[model samples]
Target: MKACISRWASEPFRVFFPLGMLAAIAGVMMWPLLYTGKLGFYPGEAHSRVMIEGFMGAFVIGFLGTAFPRLTGNASWSCGELVWMILLWATTVASALNGQVLVADTVFATLLLLLSSGMIGRWACGNRDTPPPGFVMALAGILGGALAAGLLAWNQKYPLGFTSYQFAKLWLNQGFLLLPLMGIAPYLLPRFFGMESGHSFHDSPTPPPGWWPRFTASVICALLIAAGFALEAFGWSLVGHVLRATVILAWFASETPVFRRGKLSCTPGNVARFAVVALILGTAAAGLWPLARVGSLHLFFAAGLGLAVLAVATRVVLGHGGRHDLLVGRIVWLRIAAGLLVLAAATRMTSDFVPAVRVSHHIYAAWIWAAGGSVWLIFVSRYLGRGEEEPS
Candidate 1:
């Protein structure tokens, strides 16, 4: 079994992480989608988040495990990669479909899959890119993230308490996002098309806060998220607010500049660029976090952060896969899933969101989440089956 994982380190792991994140997102959208107000068969929103996050971790670990090495032209996974991917995905899907992520299920979910995936990912993220620091940063971030995930899972020996929720949120926010952004964004930012960063716009060797500051903030953010979950769940709303404020401030301060620094913008001509408005809306929402009512924070996160992810992923797939496809015939999606996400976010924010007299909310959420995922999957399937890597 050890030898098996060692051998097949690269591809399956890489593919799984993003796929898992997609699952978590889907589960969230599925619940609360009933016009009839009947909860979907998916886990309630809270459990759904962690369960899906587990799925995301599964893929990320898999990807980082091998891709890290591959970036430096070092090598690929040793073995057992497929087994890990299948088991994890199967369990996650089962958990999600069940509608309740119990302690036992969470334990099982971590045991047979998430934990193992992290270990493998850590093994793969051994090398660093030579000419640039992007690969190195990504490698380090992924390894750190994997370690964090393992620790979070390990800490889950108890019931689904507040601490576990914080850990779960950290896994998504920090392990899944912060680390990857710290590591890969620099690389992906430039070589977006899987090609050279031709104009030399974002050309850089070191990343933000001179590495140390970035690391400090990332670690702090993780801790704060964990603390916030614990405090909030325990009814310590004041502490939770304080922790969230700190984390959010750090997150924005650290991250917002990266986008601003570069002259390179998301191609306005690129249909993907439409996500910018969504991001702006999200940023605005975040800026107003304390004031907003119930679903506002979610709107910003989904529209700004999550929606941007959809646009970016779809664009990346098209560009990398050599497609360059655009919107769903004509309308916008969550950032864009089905055109429904736009409406969904609006509805979430306003509740009275337009006269959606009949259609269920979950359908819109599912379509939005599934849309980009489906497109990405289609591209991957085609890419894997057809021929060579995307042309350089």
Candidate 2:
């Protein structure tokens, strides 16, 4: 038991990926329970909090905790740090489950602080390499999350006005997740498509000349996205959404081959493309049709960020488990899971637009999302503990 725990600690994803999926399942199940009268209170805020802070938060921490050390040539997370993170994360989920939104957000803020402090320490001392230029967005993301979490906690105590509340939500949901995804994609996604990433981590103390241009562009995009959020908070919803979508599209066009042919032929690549499209479409739809903001954002949440997380997690698991052969070919389970997520997103949107079947479709969408998460977990859990030296 001691040895097993130690081994799992060596790679944070081994523990947190599974935890993330479970949180996702728990989050979606809230709706069903509420409709069936099993739950006493409305689950709107709790559900969103759990899905975003608990589900997505777990994956972010797991990925960064594992990858950050490698990117900077620093030591992996200490056992103490891992223990504290898990405790805090688990507490956040539990508090959210009990509808203690303030408590959950406060704990989540602490977790982000801990994570950021470790990464900053690595960057400031005893690091042999610099992370890619795009990681500036990642830094922005964590700081944004911490700020949003703090605001949310404060709002629970002393109600924030409508604009302030919406601003916090925007920061927590879109800004926190989207920034990191866009930042990391340029550095990581190429590897999934069997192409060399130009921003791959190296042991150089200083970045190459070519790195600065991309770095400046990423910083600019990140700022624009934040400004867009501010615009939305100030009631310029349409302008904000359009600006965000345009910036996202332009950034991807410049940094990735997302719009190009031949690169996204593989299952993971296709899913990656779908994720980006969902994000752009969702952002635009929320602006063009403000009445359907709830449904439109699901495309960004359930399909965009959710599927991207699964695709990247799958690659990480397979690669680290010595199953590189499976990374390219049509992995039937992953394809099915991705299809289900798309279906869920559509079903959820339909619930918002078609009032006749709103309740039923909302429940159906939740179940579909849960089903997709289960499928992913069932397949990927197989690779979690396998030694990297093991044969495929």
Candidate 3:
């Protein structure tokens, strides 16, 4: 038992990635149960927390724990770091399950802060190479999430009279999740497309000539997102989100040429690209149609977050396990999963637009969401623990 615990604890991704998927799957499943009056309590806020912070948070933790050391050329995270992560992750999940939002947020904030500190320390001590802009954005996103979590915890304690939950929500949803995505996607998407260094087999993308252009673009993107969120907080919801979504769409539009470069079939690369489009569009939809925000929000979850997680998780599992072929292969099931998620997103969005079909749509969306996660776990989980690249 000790050995088993030690094994999982040492490998952050191995322990957290599957758990994250499970949480996401369970969260989706619960939504339908809530709608059907089958469940006594439906912690909608808690459900969002688990899906976004819990599910994506786990993947982020695992990825950072695995990748940060490599990028910084720093020593692998200590056993102490892994142990703390496990303890905190377990506690946070428990708190979330029990509807202890404050507790979960506080723990998550601490974890983010700790991880950020470690990475910053390593950057300070290690070689003087300028870090990737995407990486910088990601670190900033982590800190931003920490601040949001801290604020949420404070609100719980001090009882800030006004409703600031939306602010916290935006910060986590856009600032924490989107900014880092902007930073990393440029670098990773190219690799996924087999466009890096104009070669397919290279494990990493060839760094762009002079990171300044990408850095400048990243900074602008972050500023636009931040501004949009700020506007939303200040009661300019439509204007703010429209502006934000426009920027995202424009930025993504700029990347369309890359997608056009090759056969745009049902490949993982296209799935990822589609995920980006869905994310931007969903964000815009949420802003434009306020009444349909719930539906649009689920669209973001199912197509945006859900599909992207599937793509990246598969890549990590395969790349790390020395099975890049399977990772990049034209796997039919992967396409089917992506299609199901798209269906889920459509069902969710329509739930708001058409009242008559709401209940049925919710049920459809929930099952489709669960199906997507199930496909991933069945196929991808097997490869996750195969690699011991990260040290124990």
Candidate 4:
């Protein structure tokens, strides 16, 4: 038992990713009841908090915990560090389930703080090799997560106007999360497609030759988006999003050959490429028509963030285990789940235009989303831990 636990601790994703997926399914499953007042608590708040901080947040932690040390060429996490995080995360999930918002938020904030500190400490204590630009962006995301957590805790404790929490939420999802997603995509996608050139998980890619300019621009665009939030300038933020989207679109186009070279069909990476396109269109639509902001944004969440997380999680679990064949061969249900997610996004967006059917559409969308999440929990849950790597 001790040996197994220690091994599991080494690959944090083994513990967190499946937990995140289950949380995602449960959150969506319950949304309709909450929205319709069949349940007493605030469904929107609880659901959003769980899906963002719990579901997606878990993957972020697992991936970063597993990858950060490697990126910095530092020592892997100590046993104590992994155990502590596991306890804290488990407590957070329990707290959220029991409607202990204050407890959940507080615990989550502490977790983010600890994670950020650990990442920074690793960089500070490691060898003198210059870290990649992606590492820096990841750190920025961790900082943003910390700020978002603090805002949530404050709002729960002091009852400040919603703006602070709202801004924090926006910062967490749009600015912070986007940075790492964009930064890591350049590295992760080629591996997903099994490209002959570029980086593979086994062989870390050389940092892009023109790293500084690209990193700086990404930072500037992210900052502008945050500034728009601070000033409540939706249009300005949309401009930043558009610029970001354009860059991502270009990157996708440039990498088409690499994608084409891969043997996998409907692999997570390929699905995520479509997700990126959805994100671009969603941002554009939200910017163009203020009335459709909420609806339009779901396109990014469901298709972009939602599918992207699944893809990355699938790739990480399979790739690290040296079972890349499963991704293309037996994972047909994964493709179906991805399609359902796109449908869910479309259904939810259409609801905004059809007010008469909005309530029904929302429920339908929720069910579709839940079903999509359920597919992963049923199929991939066992594999998450099977790939745990021994400490280097």
Best by lDDT: 2
Per-residue accuracy of model 4 over 1-392 as CA lDDT, tens digit each: 77767766667888788888888877776668877777777666666667767887788889988887777677777788888887887777667766676777678878888888988887777743445554556677778877887777778758756566667777766656666676567566766665542322232233445566656755664565456566443336556556656655665555333335565554676777777788778767776666877788888788788888888888888777666667664478778888899999999999988889888988999999988988877777666656535221
lDDT of each: 0.45, 0.88, 0.75, 0.72
Alpha carbon deviation, residue 320, candidate 3 (Å): 0.7
Ranking by lDDT: 2, 3, 4, 1
User: Candidate 3 at residue 35, lDDT?
Assistant: 79
On a 0 to 100 scale, what is the lDDT of residue 371 in model 1? 56
- How well is each residue in 1-392 modelled by candidate 2, as lDDT tens digits? 77766766667988999999999999999988998999988988899989989999999998888888888888887788889999999999999998999999999999999988888899889658888989889888998898899999999889999988888889998888899888998898887766667666456777766788888988999999999999999999999999999999998877776777644367787888899999899999989989989999999899999889988899888888998888776999999999999999999988888889998988999999999999999999999989789866
lDDT of 3 by residue, 231-312 (tens): 8887898998789878877765563333456433336777887888788788888888898988887767678877777777
Pick the TM-score winner.
Answer: 2
Taking all chains together, each candidate's TM-score versus the true structure is 0.60, 0.97, 0.89, 0.85
lDDT comparing candidate 4 with the true structure: 0.72
Q: Determine which window of 10 residues in candidate 1 has minimal summed lDDT.
A: 197-206
Compose the digit string of candidate 1's lDDT tens values, residues 36-58: 46655434443444433454445
Model 1 misses residue 36 by how many Å?
A: 6.2
lDDT of 3 at 113: 94
